[model samples]
Structures are given as C-alpha cells and as structure tokens.
Target chain A: MWAITRLLAGKDLRVEMRSRVIINQVVPFAALMMVMFAFALDSDTVLARVAPGLVWLAAMFSLLVIVQRSFALEAADGALDALRVAGANAGGIFLGKALALAAQLAVLEVILLGAALVLYNSHIVGSGIALLVGTYFTATAGLAFVGTLYGGLAVGAKGRETLLPLLMLPVVAPVLIGATRATEAALGTNGATATDGWPWVGLLTLFAVVFGVGGTLSFGSLIDE
Target chain B: MNPLINMDTRATSTRFTSALGLATLIGLGWLAVFGLFLSPNDRVQKTGVRILYIHVPSAWLAYLAFVVTGLASAGYLWKRTRSLTLDRIAGASAEVGVLFMGITLVSGSLWGKISWGTYWTWDSRLTTTAFLFVTYIGYLAVRDLGGSHEQRARRSGVLALLALVEVPLVHFSVRWWRPLHQQESVAKGKLSDLMLFTLFVGLVSFTLLYVWLVMHRQRVAALDDMVDDGGLDRALADRRSEGMP
Candidate 1:
C-alpha cells in the first residue's frame, strides 16, 4: 500500500512538474486573491489585522482549483477507469492524490505567507512562528483529504465545476475557522497568546485524522463505476 | 398494465399518512395557541422569548432530520441493507431538514435582534448552524446530480457519512473561534413552568410535522424514480420499434 501510494504520488507530482499548472496558474491566482484583499480592505491596519484570515481564505479557494485539476487529470483520459481495471488499491489512489495536493498547497501557502508579510505588512511574533507552521501542516492535510474526496465524488458529473465547490466548501469551514484562528494567534494580532493556537491546531489535526481515515476507507465505494 | 410501470398518478397518500397529517395539524394549532397566548412572558426577554418555541424545536427537529438522513444513507451503503428506499428516505429527510434548518436560522436571527441588538452575530452556535445548513444543501445538490440510482446512492452515502463526521469538528472549531452566547436557558431550567410546557408542545408538534413531511416526501421520491426508469424504458422500446419498421 505504501509503495503504491509513493508511486501514484510521484506520478502526480511528476505530471504536475511537467505541466507546471500549479506553479503557473494556481499560484498567481492565489497571489492575485491576496492582492485583491489588500485592495478591498484598503487600510493597512485592517489588512494587517486580518491577514491571517485572508491567507487561509486564499488557500481555501486555491484548494478548489488544485483538487479539480488533480481529479480532472484522471478523468480527462480515462485514467481513473484504467486504474480501476488495473486493480490499483483505491485507498492508495486517495492518499496519493491527497498527498500531491498537500505538497502543492504547502508551496502555495509559503508564497501566500510571503504575500501577506509583504502586501499586508503582517508580522509574525517569534514564539508564534512554530504555531503558524503547525497550523499550515495540519490544516493543509485536512483540506487536501476533503478536497480530494469531494473532487472524486463530483468529477464525472455534469456541471462538476460548480458542483465541486458547493460540495466541498461547506465541509472545509472547520479548516478555515481553525487555520485562521491559529494563524491569528501566531501573528499575535488579536490579543491571542501563542498557546491559544495549539488547541486550534489540535482541532485541525483531529479533522485531518477523521477525514484521512474516512476518505481512505470510503474512496473505493465513492469512485467505483 | 406492465408490472414494470406504475400508472397511478394520484399523490402518494395513505390512511396512515392522512392520520399523521391530521395529528400534525392539530398539534401545530395547539402549539400556536399555547406558545403565543397561554405562556407567560419572561421578565427579561418578554414577548421575544416566545420565538424560542418555534426556534428551539425547529433546531432540534432539524438535527433530528439530519440524523435520520445519515442513518438512511448508511443503510443504503451497507450491502446487506442496500435499497433505493433508503436512498429516498435519506433524500427526503435532508430536504425537510433544510426547510426546518432555514426556519431555525430565521427565527434565531429574529431572537438575536431582540436580545443581542443585531440581526446576526458571529456567535459559535449561529455559525455552526449556518455551516450545517449549507452542508446539507450541498448534499441535496449531489443527490440532484444526474446519475444511475446506484451511483447516486453510493456517492451520496459516502458524502452524508463524511459530512456527518465533520459536524462536530465544525462545531468545536467555531465554538473555540468565538464563544459568546447565553448558556442554553432550557437546559438550565431557567424558564417558567408554562414556558417549559409550551416548549415541550412545540417540540412534539414539530417532530410530528417532520414525520408527516418525510413520509410524503419519501413516497414522492419513489414515484419520481419510477417515472425516470419508465421513461427510459419507453424510449428504448420506441427505438426498437422504429428499427423493426
């Protein structure tokens, strides 16, 4: 299972590397969203105060694009059906796709943090830096698991472009709430101590575990033809 | 008459369903009188407290409805219990649940206006309820996505299960994000006896109404599936006849 997972994850990453869709399209889109937030908020104080939330919001929207692209790759050329016929383990497929999504999102988030720091002029306190990284890791994992699962669910359907977001966004509300709060605590912008961020990270970790196990167990039944 | 096709065009009603509807109507009327005219005003909230009769019960029933939906979806997914009926039940319950959830939110908003001096607040309970409402709405959308019945069942069953698991996570995250709301008055036995009784009446009536609606909705869903299947069969038959001629 681990071998299959590695192989599929490597395939997705290599495909992504060759295509450069995440680097070329999704990254700019996420950065543009951060810039747009700066424009909409306009005030430096307000922008700095809410930078954590803006960053996660940008990440969440980018998640939709990345998940759609991941599943769309499989759907475009009957790759999913071929995998099924080849008797590939469904759990491995789910984990591999989710792993690839998390990797891409990790990179996107690093860039988003830079954008927040530069554009929003947000400063992360020394103690909170570790909390901020923890939030990114756990929250990204949670979002990837959910995004991949719902992407597969909506992939073959008509109007899937609209359907995927509708199906996915509500479920990921926890990640948005948790990640934003943890990030805020890390930035020390809202009178929250760095210790306050750990509990939210715990929530994110719980979410990741629940969906990660749940997604692996159920992905076969969901995407089965 | 083909056994494969049901020709009945009448509404899916039965004697038991009629009895259930009648009981719901009577219960609703009783609740309205008691909740509005009979129950005493709270010293603090006064007339605004009356909305609790509708708001609290609607919220409870909405949760109940979603629970029913989750169970029905589980039944459909389990091979030993798999059936289109369970899928229909899940779909029906979710539809009714959304309606009740909408009522809960609107009423809660009104209550908030009276109590919190705003039409909306980012309170934990309010946020979680809103998220649950949207989640179920998305679940219903997935059900409407075109697919074979089995495909619909499998996809939505997995979704329902996943969404159900996320509810607690969403609740806790929101609660921690901002915890502000009066502690639940009912659980604390803070209400007067008459108010409590009226609230009880509200709960019973709303539950009955949920049952009546879900029963009718499930039957309608079964009929809808039959019509869809029958239409495809008729189309195939027509094509075959055209080729023969």
Candidate 2:
C-alpha cells in the first residue's frame, strides 16, 4: 500500500516537475492575490492585522485550483483508468493525490507567507510558529482530502468547474476559521484572545482525521464505474 | 398480502401526505393563535421572543431533515439496502432541509437583531447555522449536476453522509470556541410550562409539515426520473435513426 502510494505521489510530482504548472501558474496567482488583498484593504496597518486571514484565504483559493488540476491531469487520456488497470488500490490513489496536493499547498503557503511578510509587513518569528505550521498542515490535510474526493465526484458532473468550488468552500469553513484563528495566535496580534489557539488546532486535526479516513475508505466507491 | 399486488405506492403515499399536511396546517394555526397572540412577552425580550416559535422549530426541523437525509444516504450506500427509493428520499429531505435551514437563519437573524442589537453575530449557533445552510445548499447543487441515476445516487449518497459528520461539530463549535448563541433551551428546562407547550406544539406541527413536504418532493423526483428516462429513450432513438451504433 505504501509503495503504491509513494509511486503514485512520485508520478504526480514528476508530472508536476515537467509541467511546472504549480510553479509558473499557481504561485504567481497566489502572489497576485496577496497584492490584490493589500490593495482591497488599502491600509498597511489594517492589512498587517488581517494578514493571517488573507494568507489562509489565498491558500484555500489556490487549493481549489490545485485540486482541479490534479484531477484534470487524470482525465487526459484516461490516466485514472490506467491506474486502475495497473492494480493501484483506491485508498492509495486517494492518499497519493491528497499528499501531492498537500505538498503543493505547503509550497504555496511558504510563498504566501513571504508575500504576507513582504507586502503586509507581517511578523512570523515567534513561539506561535509551531502552532502555525501544525495548523497549516492539519488544515491542508483536511482540505486536500475533500478537495480530491470532490474533485473526482464532480469531475464528470455538469458545470463541474463551477460545481467543485461551491461544494468545497462550505465544507472547509471550519478549517478556514481554525487556520485563521491559529495564525492570529501565532502572529501575537490577538494575544491569546478569546481562547488559546490550540483548540483551533484540535479542530483542524479532527477535520483532517475525519476526512482523511473517510475519503480513503470511500474512494473505491467514488470511482466505481 | 402480496407486496406488489395492490400497491399504488404514489397514490397511497399522496393521500397519506395530504392528511398529514392538513393536520399540520391546523396545528400551525393553533400554534400561531397561542404563540402569537396568547403567550405573554418575556421579561427580557418581550415580543421579540416570539420568533422562537418559528425560529426554533425551523432549526429543529432542519436538523431532523438532514438526519433523515443521512439515514437514507446510509441506506443507499450500503450494499444490502441500496435502492433508488432511498436516493430519492435522501434528495427530497436535503432539499427540504435546505429550505428550513434558510428559514432558521432568516428568523434567527431577525430575532438576533431585536435582542443582540445586530442582524448578525459570530455566535456559534448563528455561524454554524449559516454554515449548515451553505453546506446543504451545496449538497442540493451537487444533486443537480447531471449523471446517470446510479452514478448521481452513489456520489450524492456519499456526499450526504460526509456532510452529516459536520453537524455535531457545528453544534459544538460554539461551546468549543465561545458561547455566543444560547445553549439548548428545551433540554435545559429554561422555559415555563406555557412556553414549553407552545414550543412543543410548534415542533410537532413542523415535523408533520416536513413529512408532508418530503413525500410530495419524493413524488416529484419519481416524475423527474420518468422524464429523464424518456429523454434517454428519445436520444437513443435519434442515434438509431442516424445509423450510429
């Protein structure tokens, strides 16, 4: 199972390396979003205060595109069918695609963090950095699981391009809420306000576990012809 | 009795639904007369508290609708009991659930404005309810994305079950985050006898209304299936005439 997962993940990454889509297209899009958000708020101080939220919004929006792109790669020339014929386990495929998507999101988050620091003059060097990274991965795991599952479910759906986002954005609300709050805590802008950020991390972890396990178990059913 | 011998399932179900609808209408009228005109104002909220009659019941019904959707979804996905009937029931309940969720949010917003001095609050209940509304609206939207009946049912059933996982999380998120919305009222025994009675009447009536609506909606879905099949037949006939395989 692990071998299949690694192989599939490697396949996705190799394809990505050759195409350079995430580097060339998605990263630039994330940078553009950072500048757009700064302009939309039109105040450096206010933007700095809200930088955590802007960063999360940028990651999630980018995630929607990455998820779609991952599935779109499979749709070309029936690569998904080839994977099935090659005897890849459904669970492994789910995990591989999700892992690949999560890896891409991690890179995107790093780039977006730089953009936030550069554009909004946001600070990240603090004890809350641990909390921030943990929350980002947990939240990304949750997003990647659903995004991939829904990507497959909606791939053949009518108005699929529009359907995927509408399906995903709502389910990820808690993740956004958790990631944003946890980011705020890490940045010390809120100063342990309302509740400490750990609970939000706990929520994100719960989302990650639930969707990760649920998607793995159900992927076979989702792809059944 | 042979199961298929005399079963006019739609006719029988339609008759039963009409009776339930009539009972619900009468019950709602009773609730309105007592809740709107008879129940005295709260010391704190006064007349504004009356929105609870509608708001609370809608909230309860929305959850009930989703639970039904979830159960039917589970039935559809499980190998032993999978059937189009379960899928139709799941779809109907989700649509009705979305409708009640909208009512819950709108009525709750009105209630909040009078009491909390704003049309919205990030209170756990209101926020979660809004999230619930959006999630199920997306559920209904996914249902509309065209597919073969079995394909649509499988995808939708899985999605429904997944969405159900969020209900408890949403319910407790406020408690986990900050207590903005009021906690469960009936369970806490916070209401007086008359107020509780009014709430009970509203709950019972709304539940009946939910049953009636779901049954009618299920019938509509069955009709939709017929039309879809007809469309497929016409398409196939056209293909045959075009000398295509």
Best by lDDT: 1
Check candidate 1 and list the clashing pairs: none
lDDT of 2 by residue, A84-171 (tens): 8888898999999888988899899989988888988877746877887788789888888878888877765558788888888877
The segments of candidate 2 whose C-alpha lies over 4 angstroms from its true place after superposition are: A193-195, B1-13, B170-175, B183-192, B230-245
- Estimate the TM-score of every prediction: 0.94, 0.90
Interface RMSD of each: 1.0, 1.8
lDDT of 2 by residue, B142-209 (tens): 78877678977888898888888876666665556666566676789877788888988999999999
The residue ranges of model 1 lying beyond 4 angstroms of the native Cα positions read B3-6, B236-245
DockQ of each: 0.84, 0.60
Specify the CAPRI tier of model 1.
high
lDDT of 1 by residue, A80-163 (tens): 878988999999999999999999999999999999999988889999989998998999999999998999888777888998
User: Model 1: number of clashes?
Assistant: 0
Per-residue lDDT of B207 in model 1: 95
